[model samples]
Target chain A: MPLPSDIEKSFAASLLDKDGRVPSDLTSYSSPVPQSRFNIYRNNVHVALIDMMAAKFPIVLKLVGEEFFRGAARVYIRANPPTSAMTINYGKGFPGFLENFEHVQDVPYLADVARLEWLRMEAYNAADRKSLGGEDLAAIDHDRLIETSFELHPSLRLLQSEYPVYSIWQANIDGVALSSVDLNSGGEDVLIIRPRLEVLVIKLASGHCDFVRALGSGIALGEANERAFESHEGFDLQLAISGLIGCGAFTGFSK
Target chain B: MTNLSSWLDKPIPARAGVGLKPEHFAEILDTEPDIGWFEVHAENYMGDGGPPHHFLSLIRERYPLSIHGVGLSIGGEGALDAEHLKRLKTVVDRYSPGLFSEHLAWSTHGDIFYSDLLPLPYNEATLETVVAHIDQVQDVVGRQMLLENPATYVTFKSSDMAEIDFLREIVARTGCGLLLDVNNVYVAGTNHDYSPQAYLDAFPFEHVGEIHLAGHAEARDDAGARVLIDAHDRALVDDVWALYERVISSGVSVPTLIEWDNDVPSWARLFSEAQKADRILKGAQTEDAVAV
Candidate 1:
């Protein structure tokens, strides 16, 4: 005789598939409710997960509008339900989904905005470490400071997007009119970090992103500065160091 | 990480608590609500660290907490997700919560995790799977887990036992406790055309470690009969409260929680809901005192 788990196997298999039929044999033959009894599970799974995605990606929802966002979200959810039980970490693929979704091609920047939103959510919950401040750097001897390799804060996330992604995301976050984001203005290098409680989303200066990227790659500060200066004009080493330290970007450094 | 060695084993009192939310974090710290205790989804604090940790650590010092696991999927067929289990252990260690509980429903299959709690048929194989899964969870977290009965819309033909009997057997086999969700009893009863009182009557109240109360949304089945969805989006209805009062009248002073997961109301409103459960709990306590 087929074991109960074997019977449940058929029921569980089609539980979340959009096109799969519910295991009808398992339900009450005479359900007082006239509908397919299995539809309840279908509706519950779709609605709850879709709502979760909507909450996590509010900016994406705003850009696409509620109806449009929900529709796309439903498709995305059915195709890609959460892999892990930790749902707070769900929807990491939504940005990529939006990028490939044909209907939203007109709103190209929407995908990057979604990325920025995902990174912010990550920063909001990432592990905490004591962040470096200018004072901490000032206490270091000049020679040692230049040679010492810096550590990126645990919550730091850097994104180099080919859209005015930061401008679009900021506009939405502030509830400012979308008109404020002039997409024609070009792309942005966005830096996100939560040194303590508040998550900061920063638009970096010219070549500063290169400097941070170099440091993130385990490059020493002096070498990181050299790489930044070689890439872009007027990449001030002092300005970059001060800017990063001021925003609590790096943790303690080792010489 | 918290100082586990110095941790006090504070159990939940027979009073009402509310599910904690982020929007009310500041308000909760600013003006500590006079609620019994607070319950939070274990997954919410699974991340490495952030405001969730900062706020939870502070709140833990003041109030008793119950770590409710919504995603553990005790009823899952597959071996529980190892990564998710580690995350759960992290949360459990960080907060030596007064109580820990998970659903009777499964939320994962294969590699895919369904966020909603899905139903399961009662049978020998499932019963064995559930019992074994609960034992593993208890060993890993080093604590007892209260299994909450699910709100179901349908029953199975492959079932060999009643829901309460399945629960009774699980408790007997694994030494696990129960978390009786009053709202779920009402909702599941109405959905399956069963009697809520009968279900509660058969409940192993002695094994109940805690209680949950939430408001459900009403819908109609195809035949237009009432189907209650365990929505947890609004205030507890009067019928559910009446059932709760019945539980209280049975001389069980279990710690109760008012759970509002979606469309969460203001801290004051949610606190008032907790206060309502507290009133019922208090009324029963006073009557017991007089009889004694």
Candidate 2:
């Protein structure tokens, strides 16, 4: 006699695999009808999960269109069903899944766009914190500032992609009259942060990206600036620092 | 652990309420409608802080709240997720909702979570599992949790107990209240060829803490049988409203909720539905007073 858990596990297995048959011990109506009845549950699971994916990745769905996106979503869902009750975190692995997904391979930038969307979702839900202004940085002793490492906001997310993911995201979302984007125009370094209620997605220069990434990793201010200068010629430390402060990227700092 | 009375400082009034949606936050704050209370999906507020918390806090200050959960998976064959329970505890402690409820159906299996309320067979084995899970939840939350009836599509021949009897036994064992969803009764009754009224009559309304009324989608199964799907996307049909009237007139004035999860209409439209329920409840109260 299988416990109810055993039946439920088998039922879940059957839902994931279309070719799988309903468990024998689990009785519903007679043969074919039971299968049909069981299909309702199967359909509910697939449709509901797919709908969640669509909500989390509307841009991806728009990029790939409904039919193709749902097809890929079905495959991704079967491989990585949500482990948490939070549907907001459902597509943590979707970007990675898109990277290796053979079907959407032709559009190589698809995965990076998905990554940007996922980061946006995360930033939207991150903890609320007060952002530090340039005055707060100036208040610190100049000598101590060199030894200080700034703490980035809890909502901050940094991404470096070989494709123009930021433009693709903006183009799809803003519906700004789709202009041709050059794939060979190097990569994009993106900064995602929620200073307050609204999440902002900003494209960063390479040197600034290196500087922000270093600060995010807890590198000292002097050391991070060194890395930024090393990354790009004619790096403007003052401009990058002010730009970061304007975006509310740093919450506080400690020497 | 918090005392039950202290945990639920503001009891939900036995009147009509509506599910809180983000789109209506500004309107709700502006208009401040006469809704008796408000309900929110617990998972939506699980994040640390954001507009969800900001809006919910403002709403919480005014109306009594009910924290309805769709993700507890109380019917799963495995142990309840400790981390999920902790997060729920945090929400309950923060909001101190008057009522906390979850569906009897399972939404998770092992590590995978299904976003919908999946049904379970009415059998001794399943009954025992549900009882234990509810017991565990009550212990962790330190408050009684109401288990809402699920709108099932299929029935198992291996089951020995009726759905009503199964619920009765669980209530007897765990001492938890019932969150009677009348729409589920209608949906399941029509699908299974039973009388929705009979199910209502058999329900232990004495233990019902809250009630839910939602719209469902109607379709036909392969066997040419009428199937009612619990879609929660439209207005309440005449039949379900009639059923609600009967339940309210049955002398139980529970905190009723109008849920519209998909294709959500304007605040005015949703509030109109709540007003309709309020009228029915008031009518029942008048009748009760006359009899008294």
Candidate that scores best on DockQ: 1
**Candidate 1 regions off by >4 Å?**
A29-36, B1-8
Model 2 residue B182 CA deviation (Å) reads: 0.5
Task: Place model 1 in a CAPRI quality band.
Answer: medium
Model 2, B216-235: lDDT tens per residue? 98877767778888989999
> What clash pairs does model 1 have?
A34-B223, A35-B222
TM-score, candidate 2, first chain? 0.93
TM-score of 2: 0.96
lDDT of each: 0.86, 0.88
